[model samples]
Target: MDFQNSLAFAKELDANDPLARYRDEFLYPQVNGKDVIYFTGNSLGLQPKRTKKYVDDVMKDWHELAVEGHFYAEKPWWDYHERLATDLAKVVGAKEKEISVMNTLTVNLHLLMVSFYRPEGKRIKILCEEKAFPSDQYMLQSQARFHGLDPNEVLVEVKKRKGEHFWRTEDILDKINEVGEELALVLMGGVNYYNGQVLDMKTITKAGKEVGAFVGWDLAHGVGNIALELHDWDVDFAAWCSYKYMNSGPGNASGIYVHEHYLGKKDIPRFEGWWGTKKETRFLMQPEFDPIETADAWQLSNPPILSIAPYLASLELFDEVGMEALIDKQKRIVAYLEFILGEIDKQVESTFEIITPKDRGCQLSVFLHGEGRSLFDYLMKNGVITDWREPNVIRLAPAPFYCSYTDMYNFGQILKEGILNK
Candidate 1:
């Protein structure tokens, strides 16, 4: 498809877009009384218009049912989180029994590590991408320290080839083979937050398992943005926040997936609490811990109903337009965005270096050569909401759900003006 850098062309594309109507479902931030072209969905998604009603229903139930809300509310607060399981599973490509919505991303990662990251005497090292998200780095470091091992000795990172911005699959597989018997775990972000490169999870997971390592993904950027089959990939465990592409509110609840192999197993070592027990036997208040026959076994406390409400609201959208349709629009829209960037780059004196590789989702991390922070400032002031990384890189994620072709064309025009003005 030939993309043009004109409003008419953009509108033509938008007119034909099957997902165009869904854009109005979200509420965007305004700049100068106009909706900003939101390009930061990788960081925080726009609030779905239906979200208010979801939260309001929860509040009303809490007001009316009081102490009995757990059992008497329309959705029933006791089983509210359960409502998210089926649709959430569909979004992430996992069985309902393999998915559980619970704590925040890092918290769930820590809890899952207790069950998956068992380091024996010879197999203690963990492999991750070099310079992972700081939170993940901190989590891995602390986990090693908690287990009485030097983090430097226990955490091995697969570095990108010198002068390359993205990691190569061969390099990761080679490192896994090199770590060999010492590799106890292989855990990394499924989609790199910096370069927006989608890792080959299936190949990597296979290699990790062949080396006797437990493989897991921190799918903070991968979930809802890219295609994932955690169950079919044989991933031992995984966790992701709901705020990014999932469109749950800020710092909302998280979801996790554990392979069916571990479900209903009493021998697996996991930190247990009342919520992890079987619901039927939960009120029985028996002393013994009876784990749920699903991924819910990892849950600790009762879920936060308010937080899960927005999540359920967002999942409704995902259900209405499945991931397959979303991905179709994602590919075309991102391609159009890239075309607009290239067209603008040709017209402007400044150079635009896109660091995000072809194996990416929606995000395009471009390095603005011969430009500075002021360019980013100019964009924000002009209503092009984007994410600025260190130096001169700006991360633009044209989320397929709400971002339109016109937003791409308009952003190109705004970008050229910013560069020419400089």
Candidate 2:
């Protein structure tokens, strides 16, 4: 498809877009009395307009039913989280029984490690990418310290080659082989947060398993952004936050996926909780812990319905337009954004070096050569909401559900002016 930098071309594309109408479903913040071109959806998604009703229903249930809301409310606060399982499973490409909502991202990762990170004498090292998300880095370091090992000795990093922006699949596989018998776990972010590179999880997971290591993914950015089949990929366990592309809210609840192989097993080595036990026997006050026959066994407490409400609201949009359709629009829209960036770069004296590789999802992290924080400030003041990393990189994520092609074109215009004025 030939790309153009004009507004008419952008409008033509938007006119034909099947997902265009869904943009009205979200509420955006205004700058100078106009809606800002939101590019931070990868960090925190815009709240769905329907979210208020979901939250209100839960609040109303609590007000009317009080203690009876647990089992007698309209949606039943006891099983409210179960409403998210089926649709959430469809978004991440897992069986309904293999997915559960709980806690937060880092918290769930810590709990999952209890079951998957059993390091024997010879197999104690963990493999992760260099400069992972700060939360993940801290989590891995603390986990190793908890097990009485030097983090520097127990955590092996797969570093990118000098001057390169992304990791090669071969390098990661080679690192897994180098760590060999010492590799107890292979856990890394599925989509790199810094450069927006989507790592080849299937190949890496296969390599980790071949070396007798338990493989898992921190799908914080990968969950709703890219195609994932944790069950088919034979992933042992995985977890993600709902605030990003999933569009729940700020620091909302998280989702987890555990393989069916570990379900219904008494010796799976997980922390026990009343909510994780079988529902029928939960109120019976039994002495023994009978784990649920699904991924819910990993849950440690009853889900917070207020947090899950917005998530379930977002999943309704996912159900209306499936991931397949979302991915289709994502590819075309991101391609158009790239074209706009190239066109703008040609017009301006400054260089825009896009570090994000072709394997990216919605985000395009660009190194703004000859630009500074003032340019980012100018963009924000002019109603372009983007994320600025340290140095001069800006991440522009035009999420498919709400972002439009005209936003990309208009951003190109605003960006060119910002560079020229500087």
Which window of 10 residues has the lowest lDDT sum in candidate 2?
Answer: 73-82
lDDT of 1 at 13: 97
- Candidate 2: lDDT over CA atoms? 0.95
Query: What is each predicted model's overall lDDT from 0 to 1?
Result: 0.95, 0.95
Instruction: Name model 1 segments beyond 4 Å from true.
Output: none
Q: Write the per-residue lDDT of candidate 2 for residues 235-321, one digit (tens) a residue.
A: 999999999999999999999999898999999888989899999888998999999999998887899998999999999999999
In the range 1-422, model 1's lDDT, one tens digit per residue, is 87788999999999999999999999999998999999999999999999999999999988888979999988998888989999988888899999999999999999999999998898999999999999999999999999999999999999999899999999999999999999999999999999999999999999999999999999999889998988898999999999999999999999999999999999999999999999999999999999999999999999999988999999999999999999999999999999999999889888989999999999999999999999999999999999999888999999999999999999999999988887
Off by over 4 Å in 2: none
Q: Record all residue pairs in model 1 with backbone atoms less than 3 Å apart, i.e. clashing.
A: none
Q: Give all TM-scores, in the order shown.
A: 0.99, 0.99
